[model samples]
Target: MAEPTAPPAAPSLQELQHWTGVLGRAQQMMMEAGIDMMAQLPAAKAAPAFPAMFDPAQAMRAGAAFWTDTLELWQRFLDPAHAVRAEESPEHARDRRFRAPQWREDPVFDFLRQSYFLIADHMVKGVDSLEGVEPRQKEQIRFATQGFIDAMSPTNFPATNPEVIEKIVETRGENLLKGLQNMLADIAKGQMTQSDTSAFELGRNLAMTPGKVVRRTPLYELIHYAPATKQVFETPLVIFPPWINRFYILDLTAEKSFIRWAVEQGLSVFVVSWRSADASMKDVVWDDYVERGQIDAIDTVRELLGVEGVHAIGYCVAGTTLAATLALLTARGEADKLKTATFFTTQVDFAEAGELSLFVGDEQLKMIDSLSSDGYLDGRYMATTFNLLRGRDLIWNYVTNNYLLGADYAPFDLLHWNADVTNLPAKWHQSYLTDLYRDNKLVMPGAMQIAGTPIDLSTVKTPSYIQAGREDHIAPAHSVWKITDHFTGPLRFVLAGSGHIAGVVNPPSANKYQYWTNEAKVSSLAEFVAGATETKGSWWPDWLQWIEAADATRVAARGARIPGKGKLQALADAPGEYVKTR
Candidate 1:
């Protein structure tokens, strides 16, 4: 008790001053760190003049209007009784964020919230006004700026976020703890583990369609889905999905499976299940994908079906590969192997290949080559690039749910499929990036080569049905339309009303999206889109109709179409070992 009465006096003035100086130094260090982070943002060469956006007066007018609205919002927030209704912008909505009663009714947060939007809007304007920069550089700048803005979002921090605060209080900080654990777990994996692996077992719940692996090569396995109809079409349908992902995207679930729907429609459906490339397959080049991947699948399908003609489908990069294969086959006078061809979200002309083209510059290509010293493009690298293309949905969305809210995202089949990625062979990926993406070579007649054959897409005379996604960033609709310019055959082009995956995976039953069709082939994409009429429901039925018209003879579908019949032996069950590897 006596010692407590003589409690230690306050620290000496010198000690207090020293502690103050230490705190000041710590703040200076933090500020320096922040400046370093900003300095590390991607750099770009100046772009050409921004159109009308370069006028200073116009910018000032916009700034004045923004400030006026901000002042009004502030005035309303200052009022005691009047509840200020937060303005909702399309890209960055704030009112919808702080929905909890405590936040919605509070004036203090209202001011903080609107101020963020105003500042973000200013930042975007500044980025948009950037002139004399290359398109890739511009994209990098916009992307970096967006990352910064998203990081600064109040909703990401519990102290500034009312919703997170309420969640913390209600859950007694369990949410924060779970979020930290989730973050640490992802950091340990060196990648964002987007889906709950415990929630899905590949062969059982995901790629459960019943079929047989009719043939296998060093590169892929060909799976023939069991026919769900009593009679099947005479011309067998072979699909060449992009090697960047597993073929099961077309067979993700029974109800939504494009293969199942085609099989049900009485078409003998065969999918190319591309093997996830490893260091062992590093020598595999684009020719291998063409010859061994698509060409081999076609040959096996012909042997199994005993039909000289087969209908072929290619999606995204596979569309490019399939087109190349068909061209090579046509050059070799073996074009009769495929009766008809359908391209989904494919880009033969890379002139307008959308945002993904930004990653194919000289520096990026060198980096990729260095990475491929092991002989394959890492699947995680490919996945990360694709995620950045749609950062808001694929990156930030998962980040918020998994790291901020400490919650598991609702189990989504598409999200699961997206998370599942495949590697590209080093030689193959290098050729693809250089020839297709960088040089825009495939569109040029005889500019590319495969299996010692000079490839020219114009020689690919297979009757084609080209389907594009309206919002596809990987393969823009404009780029897909350019394929029509290269093809000499009858081309039926349609635009589905969704992005890359959604546009193709759209099943008729969902009735969730629409499509656009124009029978007349126009010279420009604008004309095509203008003349096209929007049709409700999925484009699958229309595509089926097109393929069906190519070969109308229907035979009795008594048994499931297996792969190994005459020469090729049955390798394994459907969704073979290749798809389950990674």
Candidate 2:
């Protein structure tokens, strides 16, 4: 009997149907009321009149109405017994003492209170305006009344105090509206941070495996590139990435990785991953980055690969160092070993450095001098400076989205990669800012010297590919393109899309962005400017073609591998550990 009674068929179909009908009716009623209220909205916006609504006298009477409605609603939802229990909790007690709404001191709270009065004043004026209305117009009046009442309803405010919510609505209405619009625009721009590509995973996988560290006599790593065929080039390719960051920018990820792409294209590639400098490296000047960093890497690649000479690629700050190194090599009649050189978004002239000019002025320089007096530029300082350049998009946008919108935006691996910043040696930063930015001395023939030798770009005859970014704020395209004037050999100037990082790490797949090329045979920037054609497609293909043409002839036979080791040591993988460190 108990089993028979237990089920009661768990409410038969008819009972369920009845309940569903009730819910449907309730929903329909709400919708009808909402529609009726919305119908009363003005066909056209009314003209604005200052001091016509929410006058101080009207607000006083309105405030009384809001207080009465708010207290009734609060009492229903928040029982006095529940409040007493909540107060018993230590967390609640602390919040009540320190975080409770202090209307007197809080501007936001005061504004919300004022909004309550404003609503009441408007309601009174609406009633007064309806004095001459006929019986048929009574329905329309009721609709309008309902609309205003709905807007100021206690249920509309998420907070217990309706007055506080009202104040917030009044005080922050325009700003909140503007913020919402901006957020939508950012979403459309795809300027929002995104996850690093699947290619990043491939690169990370390659670099994490165990490998050998074959230290050259002086310094540097001779990374071997094993191609499909024995018919490889006579000249080795050595990549000199700046010590300012990690070397991985060249080899970023598999797809966008320039180093990997070169290897696939049949060019043997060797990238130098500079060691993180320690406190002892404070005295290590710009010369050390060139002679010791790039030159040493070149020699190791030559010896390991058994090539006649190496083709060098310098990126950003590394490019400048390479220019200096080339000058020194040329002065000593040692430039014959080098083939072609490529500079990616690198600046040699500093006079028109764009926004960077502001931070490198006299007062800023003095501050930097004091900070870097201990020798190495602190990494945090450098990161702060770059972050400031795009503060709205990079910093404030995230703050609003995360805190205000309560959006847990997924962290982009690339952004995470960017945030993992490394410190610069004090000597390098101080000398760079003063000599390059402040003094504008690098482009001059003998204005700057490395290792006591006057460095000059003209002396080095390596054909060059100088690429700049149109949207790049860090190194303006003009400042970078000026390098062509300093070089006597054939030069190709490319202007790509996006900022400094995106422009350089650009993949061929991102074909939406384009580059411009000056007319053929126009060697100088001025000539290019007059005859430049905006070309579609990625600059990577163009750069690859240029480098391939400039490359020295490939040997008929594969040169013998350096004799010393039978099984050469292998690098761990693609994205090495050094690149992963912050």
Candidate 3:
């Protein structure tokens, strides 16, 4: 009647219930079929004639044991009074209110969060593709999957959903408890705060290493080491460690120290330890470092111990300085005093300096200019720059372990030494960056000048030994090897294992570390690169062999005296006061 309208559009309770029941039945049927198929899959995959040695009994027992322990832990954690207090805690309240909404409101982040689950769902289907993977590899893959799932579980998500909130609270509480326990354990084991003490001790030890004060025209300390017995060579050995850090990196510790090793090997070792710059040293330029730092030390060594010539070992930036010094001396016909020179982990060419190039661009130069306007390149600035190069390991690792994990810092002497920062004269640093890094001028003939003479490496007739590390990111191998081509001397280039610091600190005990040497003559790096083979052991032994051949036979021992003068006044001991002056 009511216009013969369609039956009142309404779902009766009975109809609704019937449809729900049918849906329930269909879901049950699908679940049962899925379970059955899953159960038969392993049987189908079982090797041809033999059944799997399925240890269901053992698995059941293990599951029972795990559940039993879990129940006990759950009971302890769910104490009513404690649970109520934890729920009302500040952290919990913060998480429940502000943090959850803030996290969800991030647009790009929400997209990523939703996309993760979709990708994970697809990955579950992709597991079938791994059927032929090795059993161990399959287990590894499963473990990795579980690990990722655990990391991304609701417990780690900040959300308003009841399940996610509860899980987050529970997991964070557990983590807090574990962290406190670890802190206490470390304190009891005497591992906590060891880093600070170790660093302090390293500074103390470096300050105590005896250094000699050799007074020349330019006042600087010359750390000298002469073997107890007759010297192996008539040529004195002088070591010029880079001024970027302290000179003592080559003499870090007695057992593994390079300077100690060279001294014990019967070579006269003289190291140039530059003083930390003061207001007076503000105008010191690159030429000043060579003239006052290297050349003055050379004159002191020559005058103090009258030697026919000296063998020089220059490392990193010091090597560059030494090469320039050699060129200058050659131009003036004064290079006859140097018989041989060795460069360690040093770069003459800047075409491919790797990560170091990134920080030397215009912006950084401007920043340096602003800061160094006071005449000194602040040591802190330099330290921060180097630290940024490997921030994950250098900076963030310590932050996470110290602040988050509440773990004690592990002290390493080398790291302590590295952190002993030193400032560079602003003029020297700015000129270095602009000339060497920006222009790559030092390696180019007639591009660099020292003491008013155009310096060129081809005129460097001193027999040369060049060493670089394969894993050195600061100075790429290609950039370092370019020095060989620029020189006409009998050059031997060795490639060592490890990075910049480790490469220099390498000792014979590190036998597993390998190096490459070209026994046959090779003109360029390309030629040597083609024929090089990896050989085990430290490159020091090889360097020593080359040095011994260049050194002259030892003559009668002369007392410690400045040559061309009356007998020299003796200093306290071998390691004099100069190096110990910080």
Candidate 4:
């Protein structure tokens, strides 16, 4: 012992007794949050699966592995020479809550973030690894577990989040008071605010493209967008947007407006403005929308243009109805009336429908029916269902911004439209859920009926252009691909770069996300993707080209400025009375 042994080195700050204790407390809070959310999973669906949901032996093994991993991490963490760092990979770095400088630069927070992920990631893998559970039921469990984990992120809690702590310190606890007030305001609004709601109006900064409402119906109003070119395609184009949402989404602003861009392309463009559902619409059925709301709009466009054939485009749910209408028309031997059909992020087959399917089972449908006080689902209910699909971006992110950080939402036109939810008529919704979602009837020959006409998708042979968003969750690209199977005619499938709205509403001026195409003969979406070529601009031009090819005859462009040409008359300005109401 000639050289006195140096005193044992003290633990690194990351592994100090006090820091470990702090982490233990933080872990407790996260676990409590997870427990609270787990308690909310629907008992009706989950109770049956509970026995098969998790193997207790496997779960214990997972728990033990998690602890083992944690111990190993602590060993590396305690080494004085080793520094803790958050994963730098794109996938791991996406948790925006940890983007703050301190989260990575400070070892304490770095350890906390890593620890939470270690636990949550194990839980996710464990749920995924569970065997013997029915495939569909297994999917529900996985989804619920992920949502619960996301809700319990360390960034969501005030004390666990250093950014929020700094805000409190900077504002001398006034941030808490402001946050409380903000929470109260959000509660009053009945939904979280994702944009500056007061910053945009229906016709001013948003949905500002010039147009006029023509031929109003009880269910919808047809709009003739003011013409942008002198000569236009002879075939008029009518857009049947999803009635579950307002029509202005396609008409938002001059730049992002798909409606405006179509007019500018020297095409006769008309849109259907659907009336928001009320108690009066309780008895409205699927056939009513197909007839009065969609088919009627198509008839109005043809009549106004004095054309035997019209081009029709449908978005989301409207596209499903369009498909049924195509079949119904075919049953009546009037299939040629619609010369061309275009579908935007629409699904006819529910076999591979995304997270929305979780809400379509009998128990949930019963709940929805019960909530329909006078026979209509509230707008907020649908909004909440969609919001839950992307809880991190849609729910907790806003929670941190509006509640913890006390910040006002940035003004965004798209989000403003998103906040404007649409109510759904009960009968229309019921038939939709039962026929399409529950029974998968639309694609089956003679299985679906619209009005008195039996619908058979294969009987409809109109040329079709199907555009599906690569990132769409509601209508997954795969689910949308099923349309190609049933169209039974010349069909072009295009995959765009972004999610549903961004992918569809994309304009070339912005020069943003890319689209994919495949000219090679391919039966399945997988083959299409394998042979697909990438294009670095909006799909709008691609669609215009398809429209031109579908019908090349040119006619004088007609706009709302003209009083009436055939059987249509201008009723009011665009972004009409229906859209302005809730």
Candidate 5:
């Protein structure tokens, strides 16, 4: 069978135009150099058309060496005594392409695997050594090259992959028919593959935490989780989860739940479950997210808990909104509404926003706005965009399993939560892309406004705790650290182990990841990392302790507080209507 071809990644028209101009100039420079070279060497037959960085002679020599290596590889394979051993590399850690016992003994498969890695390394090095290319162009070339490399991975093709071959033999070709059926089903659904949809149920298996929706608005639902402890903190804890996915990420399972954990710690836990957007919410803007989303949720929580101030925690996009809201409230001299603020992998400064930044800029932003002008931005588009960033895991892995190997996707809570995407309001998403990613207005004092008040981050002096994942590509740790400079009050920064979501979802029981915390404020991120202390396990307990210490003065044990007792009554059961909209 033919190997699966890599998804095309042709350069955009803009990139092509820019590079065409560069190449035209380069050709002009080469022609000029050729004339000069011919003038210097009267006896020469022809002039060279090469740039200073690229020497034809050197390229020829490199090509000769590559073939020499290829010849030696073949020679070793033909030798009777030749045997191959498993080679491990950081890039190919989880790759099980050539792991079968036969690969070690089979000369053909061994040589192919070896040659593949060698060629990939050479290509990467050549790209890295291109001195004359623009930084952005270099990044694009590398990204495209990496995609090709992933596509060429032996496991992606059933014939070359030993595991798939073994499976075919064991099942007597039954797996191929099953794989075909899976591919057909995926095509029918307009999905790349089956994402193991049966793995999770919204209210039954997942998002099962006991809670009641005390307040509901067009924008979001405020969920007050039933407390596990008798006495709760006088200061209520309201969590604002990212609207891109469901709020259940915070309450995924009983063991991994940060929400349930807080409840057990004697804190009145209130979570904001954002409504999945549709055509009706096409007019919802960033202002609506601020007023009707965060502010409304906060007000409802305060009213129910009867607290003057609430401890607020925001994750990802929600964190960005919360920070902006706090800035707006501060401008209006109402900063005292929040007791302590915690931000999880939130990027206020978009300067170093990582790979996602590639999809921004004027042209892309205009395209996005134009496409979603009439209605909400489809969740599938956003999901595909995110998946493209980590295609090896999110895209091609499923292609290999569901299409090539005929394997059922494993049940994973994280994957299920990730697949449950939420739509973005047209105006809201456009404003976000324009103000935050495009213009980077959040870091600029008085640059953003909400509710007729200019948002100045410097005026927001609420005590803060910021946590960022070291490997978080979406919101890089460096970008999160920049928030410290904009904040007027004391700030603590923690660098957690793992990627964007896993780092935040880490529970103490997992005991898998480690975190770094620096007590002393540092001028630069490097300085902070240098002085940071590494602690094994989740950063949740440390954050909880920080909030508890800040809110030391507590009231008598009040037992589990009932939702809607104070003001807004319970509208429905926990995980509310908005969460189950999809």
Candidate 6:
């Protein structure tokens, strides 16, 4: 027996160039027809800020530094000793992009990886080193620069990426052919595939919690999950997931479903499945969401069960509005309408709103208005904007896996939910940014109004629980903690580990991630951290304990709201009509 001959040498640079061009054409098809991804980023449409970011004086010094690094890198590349050795710094070791053994063992690839980082570092610091530029403009430039660098990673390209090159060689160019096919399939689907969507469905595998849609309106479907326990708490619990995505994220799977867990633990759960916005909802505004969407749900639920107040949980943008709804109820002398409020990774004080704020200025707003049709912001456009938030993980990772390596996406419940994007009323979306994100007015007393009532977050007396993700980019934990400044109610703030989705969707059964807790009121986030105690595992159990302790009264299973002829009419099954709109 003899070993198989070694595969042919990696594809030539010229051949790689052809594949790169094919990739460009492939991406053109992935975006939804008649939608422009660039319209969301007005800054990107303007001329390059070579002069502003790197004025002539600064450019010269940066150029000299770059050339010096390039010469040193070239010299090392020519020498077998340094070229053959991997860049073994702790920083490089942590980069997932350079984790492949070929990046270290192969000389040519190692040089490319090191050179790319060298250039990326210089580019980032060039803007940081600028003296006279406005802080906002400088920040925008820095974000754009980093996005460009992430896009041009050696691993994203064919010729430079050792793993991609090897895959191409091993497959005898079949990978490239299959990659094009994947691109075409994604194009037909109208967005990039983040997971094996075919493997999951709402009623069968995902959002399978036993429940029924008790109420339906033009804007939302109110779902009342059947009592898993024999008895339920007196105070009914309602959840308002962010309208930007589907509602079923909270009820992904039986084991992972937060809704199911809450119900099984003896709490009655009701969730608002917001209607996917269309041109007919063009007239909808911020107050409409507060009045018709959230407040209405609360009103109906209370009226049905003859309950005085409803316990509320809001996640992301929904949490942002739920805070305002509390204030609105207060202004109307109906503060008691809501018994308690729980916010998950929500931002009321946008002072530290993070990267999402980068696209909330005048130019971006006006461009969105113009791009909208019948006063509706297309879901596809919004999806692209969000995916760019962590372009490397959300966008480029799939680019390399599905296209470069010709691999299929794994079946991930969360990613499947992510790809099922929802549209928003243009008027409402613009006002959300202008009021909360851009102006930072939700915290200010009487700064904004909902349904003619002033929003004074300080007057919100409802006992509150706020949970923020420590590693969350969308809503930074520090910003979430700012809720403490205004709310006079007894509040418990817990900082959970991981990013936005992972942090919030965590279940006790998974035993994944950790959370921090502090009892004393602190002036700054730093102080809160200093006085806090760290506990390992999911924060869900902690939240359950906090909410459960407040409402201990129990009712028989028959007393729980069951959809039927006597009670509210069953609109449809759980993961109802509105959730399946798209």
Clashing pairs in 5: 230-559
How big is the positional error of residue 225 in model 5, measured in Å on the Cα after superposition?
0.9
- The candidate, 3 or 6, that scores higher on lDDT is 6
Better-scoring candidate (lDDT), 3 or 5: 5
TM-score of 2: 0.62
Candidate 5 lDDT, 114-224, residue by residue in tens = 656666665566556655555544565566566666766766888777778888999898888899998898678655643578878877778887888987888888888
Task: List the candidate 4 regions with Cα displacement exceeding 4 Å.
Answer: 1-15, 25-56, 80-89, 558-566
- Local distance difference test values of all predictions, in order: 0.76, 0.60, 0.63, 0.83, 0.77, 0.82
User: TM-score of each candidate?
Assistant: 0.86, 0.62, 0.66, 0.94, 0.86, 0.90
Q: Would you list the rank order by lDDT, best first?
A: 4, 6, 5, 1, 3, 2
RMSD of 3: 19.8
TM-score of 1: 0.86
Candidate 2 residue lDDT tens string, 1-582 = 355433112335574456445433533344345435533433111213322323566546655664454444234223423432111235323422123344323323322333333343445354444333442233333434544444443223336233334444775655345545655654674343322323344245333322233443222444454443455566767778767666655554455666666766557666676656557677878888787888777877666666667788888888888888878898888886687888987887777776666676565778888877666666656766776566545554453444233344563545655544566777788788889987878777888888788888777777888889888878888889878777777777888877788888777765667788875876556677678888776788887788678764665324333222324455444333454444
Report the lDDT of model 5 for residue 367. Answer: 76
Looking at model 4, which ten-residue stretch has the lowest summed lDDT?
558-567
Task: Choose 2 or 5, whichever is better by lDDT.
Answer: 5
Which of candidates 5 and 6 reaches a greater lDDT?
6
Q: List the residue pairs that clash in candidate 4.
A: none
Which 10 consecutive positions of candidate 2 have the poorest summed lDDT? Answer: 43-52
lDDT of 6 by residue, 391-448 (tens): 9999999988899889877999989898999989999999888888899988888889
**Residue by residue across 1-582, what tens digits does model 3's lDDT show?**
356544333345575456445433533343344334333433224423212212466435544654453334233223422432112235333532223442344322222233333333333333333443444333333433433433343323334123333443766655445546655654675332224444444335543333344442333566655454554456778888887888778877665678778766767667777766645667888998888878877877787677757888889999988999998888889997788999988888888776676566565688898988777776767876776565545554443344344445676767766666677788889899999988989888888888777898888878999998888877878789888778787888998888888876888976758888878887667787689887887889889899888864775434562222324444445344433443
User: Considering only N, C-alpha and C atoms within 3 Å, which residue pairs clash in candidate 1?
Assistant: 46-132, 46-133, 47-132, 47-133, 48-132, 214-563, 231-557
Displacement of residue 378 (Cα, Å) in model 4 is 1.0
Leading candidate by TM-score: 4
